[model samples]
Target: MDTPILRNNFKSEEYQINMGPQHPATHGVLRLLLTIDGEIIKKVEPDLGYIHRSIEKMCERDSYQQIVHLTDRMDYLSSHINNEAVCLTVENALQLEVPERVKVIRTIIAELTRIASHTLWWGVMGMDVGALTTYFYGFRDRELINDIFEETCGARLTMNYNIPGGLMFDIHPNFVNRTKEFIAHFKTKLPEYDLLLSGNIIFQKRMQGIGILSKEDAISYGASGPVGRASGYSCDVRIHHPYSNYDNVKFNEILKTEGDTLARYQVRILEMWESLSIIEQLIDNIPEGDFFAKTNVVIKLPAGEYYQKVETARGELGVYINSTGTKNPYRMKFRSPGFSNLSLLNHIAVGGKIGDLVATMATLDLVIPDIDR
Candidate 1:
């Protein structure tokens, strides 16, 4: 009987896996090298540069006007906002004050871009978490916004509407009406989005308490947009810096303290509402004046360093320019929000499941070109 004693020993070893360079959940050509112990994530390392085009270097060779269009390719979802950032930078370097009309118009269009971006994110996020119906609903509304942009700017996704001193052109005759129509339509549909996905028990179970990032960590990792806001970081460029008539509008910078997947998702959902409020405030009050400030055909900046930051759909997009009194920038660099938000992936994603990683990444709402730039 004493000789019948036995023991059982089993050990679990960590293994490595690649989530994507082609995976749909990643949303682009982003490869995440993951270390896993069965269902648990031990580490997440993002392998970027697959889609890098060295846009900053390209800016050195191109005129400032040419550089505006290049930004359209960076964060295509926030193309108009990206254009505005560079335009503001150049205008500031020249000490140019654009017309009041241009300011209100730019603000309205930018908010529309924000809503369009958030709507797309909501749908894609729902799809990522197994709700396919949200994708159709999301795009259906986005199409209306796209139509407005096309009528005004002649393009939808990569709209190079903003130039150095002002808009490339005046707003279309139907721009105001069409934008109002989108606001009216979306106001009703947004509630439906909540009923469909935001309030779902299953979604709450998956999102709540998952991939928790603290306020300190969020700031440390340079998180911004909804990612930083979810962690209670008050880093909204619009609120803090107040460029492009944002100072005139009254809207809340959406924030949450949970710092989990659900908190991030809710912050963006609320932000769409705030975008609506901002557009409403400026749509009718747009002052009558020239669409652009007068500028020379060959724009040149004073020999100095200039920087401008704008609140894009993803977050703060800072355009830094070094000028030697030339048509082209001596050196140009962009501090894209996606790059900073992406940096926090390894920080927040460790210790969650693979499914949790997908949900967390979706909430981050990354546009790979923004990061790779």
Candidate 2:
């Protein structure tokens, strides 16, 4: 008898796994349906709406001033910036010019908000990549910025400080001095961030060349802020379209060409330095004038469309308003950067490991509520 033919038919198959709706690495109530073959990711599909609040629809029901507060809940990390975006949109619609003091103060506070958001991102991002110490270091520095916000706006995280015409109130008596102190203190601590995490060999290995998004892809995907800048796309709203005295200041829009995980990481680090520079330029120069521009008790826009964009910590936030000459907007929409940035995850994450996916996602610096809203 012929020797029995021996045959092996075992074959590997792709499997599906859920990364979150609660996973810590996801950073929020985001569910990622991942298709993997062993350790390699075949595909990723983000399942959103877990944190959706229909904020755009709510805008139709609320007055212009009330809508500003609702925006604070969307990108809470960039609450002040979000508030300013809507305020700028409404002001543009009414053809209103706020006081010079309001313009400078808004710019300074906006930069502080950017730094605070970046600090929190740095800590959590480091923690996501196994650097727990960064979390503590980041929060410690961010608290100082929050203290300044509390003194000026009476709120820290969800500061509904910006109204339609201008700021709800003026800066605190100690706002300038406290901000100067933060800049001095953070300058010393920021170097430590590099020494601890940025310079780590393992981190470099993990990040460099990973999640390589090309400049063309970045622009095609509507990536903005650091994400676009890292890919060599000069999409900084501050520079491209100056608002709130941004035209008066001089600062470099941090840019990188690598478009990898490391490039994204470095862009944010450099941006913090630029944020410090912006604040220093305007902090002492806050003009002597009113903090707000006076408008009617109920703001009604001309029957037309108006749009405004501002750079938030994650990226560019665009506010679009459709008015029918009413107190509330006939229609309101937000082009949130997180939503656009999140769209490119699958494009870059294919062929990488789950761990690589986490690192790449961390660099995107997604705020789920911002996306869902």
Once fitted onto the true fold, the runs of candidate 2 whose alpha carbons sit more than 4 angstroms away are 1-9
Best by lDDT: 2
Position 266, candidate 1: lDDT? 95
Cα lDDT listed for each candidate: 0.93, 0.95
lDDT of candidate 1 over 232-296, digit per residue (tens): 99999999999989998999988899999999999999999999999999898888889999899
The collision pairs in model 2 are none
Candidate 2 lDDT over 258-308, as tens digits, reads 999999999999999999999999988889989898999999999999999
**Once model 1 is optimally superposed onto the true structure by TM-score, how far is the C-alpha of residue 228 displaced, in angstroms?**
0.7
Candidate 1: clashing pairs of residues: none
TM-score of 2: 0.98
Q: Report how far residue 163 has shifted in candidate 2, in Å.
A: 0.9
